[model samples]
Target: MSETLTPERVRADVAELLGCEPAEITPGENLFDRGLDSMRVMILVERWRAAGAASLEFPDLAECPELGHWTALLTGDGA
Candidate 1:
């Protein structure tokens, strides 16, 4: 949200919530496998929506659960 809805910002936001560095969040990695739960995903959905990603939804993320996919979805670069 600090910088526009970019992929990097998405990574940083997810990283912050996961309690790790942005670099640790590989784009193709499964966030759920990295400890991201539905509650946290919902938290991110609300946060990203507030930051202008109004179309983002929990099901959109839950169906994929990958950082790259989420980044793209939030940044308008993917489905």
Candidate 2:
């Protein structure tokens, strides 16, 4: 995992994965419900897990519903 997962980096990564503009993602909105399908979510989670073995916790991922939460997990600022 990166030493610190910044919000800016999260925004960029998510946008790239979704193939959309970063502004399309709201900070506190629920991304899955907003259009991030199960496949995408799984792929994202797996990617994070692969990025570093200790980089992700699937259960904690459930509580993360938006860019803010996702960024927190990636950066270890807390979930």
Candidate 3:
């Protein structure tokens, strides 16, 4: 289930988990500050891993709870 990881995609996924509209999720906003909990983060991690992002880890998302950062990390465009 490999697919391109884009900021839009990340935003959509995060929005789904957070029960908000994608437009409400800012690319640079901190997801944790927006109510993203550990359970949701793990759910996202598993989903991404299943989508071929095996390198993804909880801390990778936790340390940086921004959509842009997650997109870059999953897409291999950021550190």
Candidate 4:
């Protein structure tokens, strides 16, 4: 079964990339501003795609760079 993408999951992924606590990743905060790079973003894309988010892409997450937005996009609740 496909894993569901939740805000907490998104936060956890971002936290792993940033090397910080999940709570440090606020929903509306910009990930890039918090030190996220292309490499880490691609890592997240690959991980999520493997988890069944087949439609996810670098630009989709790069353009938004926010936890809530990433969660919505991954969960198919956003355009």
Candidate 5:
């Protein structure tokens, strides 16, 4: 079975790329503004997909680059 993806994991992944603590990523803040570019997003998409979020797409994140949004998408808490 694949490892379950968690909100913390999502935050940590993005934080790792940003070179900062996961807690520094505010839920509602735009990650792009925080230095997350398309290339980084593609990386997260692939990583998350490998982590069990197979349905995750680049557009799902690119259209809404927020920690909360990503967390919800990865954790299946969003509509």
Candidate 6:
């Protein structure tokens, strides 16, 4: 079975995976420009896929490419 996708969990994972503080990930923060590299993005993608379909990936994660995007993904809203 797959783990559930929860907003709090997602935010925590994103923070850990990107080496950022939770507060650094506001709703409109930009991962790339803010310091998220392609390599890190790839790692995040892989982790997401391994986590099952409930995980978010690159393209889908690229919509806003900001904190808001990540916030939306974790909250079950966004594309």
Best by TM-score: 5
Better-scoring candidate (TM-score), 1 or 6: 1
Cα deviation of 57, candidate 6, in Å? 4.2
Candidate 1 lDDT, 26-64, residue by residue in tens: 778889999999999899998888888787888999999
lDDT of 5 at 67: 91
After superposing candidate 5 on the true structure, give the runs of residues whose Cα lies further than 4 Å from its correct spot: 77-79
Over 4 Å off, model 2: 1-4, 53-55, 77-79
Q: TM-score for every candidate vs. truth? A: 0.88, 0.69, 0.86, 0.87, 0.91, 0.70
**Candidate maximizing lDDT:** 5
Better of 2 and 4 by lDDT: 4
Q: Give the per-residue lDDT digits (tens) of candidate 5, residues 29-69.
A: 99999999999999998988998888889999999999998
**C-alpha lDDT score of every prediction, in listed order:** 0.86, 0.69, 0.84, 0.84, 0.88, 0.66
Residue 55, model 2: Cα distance from true site in angstroms: 4.9
Each candidate: RMSD: 2.5, 3.1, 2.3, 2.4, 2.0, 3.0
Task: Candidate 6: give the clashing pairs.
Answer: 27-67, 27-68, 29-67
Q: Runs in model 6 with CA error above 4 Å?
A: 54-57, 74-79
Measured on C-alpha atoms, candidate 1 has an lDDT of 0.86
Off by over 4 Å in 4: 76-79
Whichever of 2 and 6 has more TM-score, that candidate is 6
Q: Model 5, residue 32: displacement in angstroms?
A: 0.3
Winner on lDDT between 3 and 5 is 5
Pick the winner on lDDT between candidates 3 and 6: 3
* Predicted structure 3, TM vs. truth: 0.86
- Model 4's TM-score against the true structure: 0.87
TM-score for candidate 5, please give it: 0.91
Per-residue lDDT, model 2, residue 11, is 78
Question: Any idea what lDDT model 6 has?
Answer: 0.66
Q: Model 6: per-residue lDDT, tens digit, 1-79? A: 6665556656666788778777667766677777777777777667666666444667877666675666566556542
Angstrom error at residue 68, model 1: 0.6
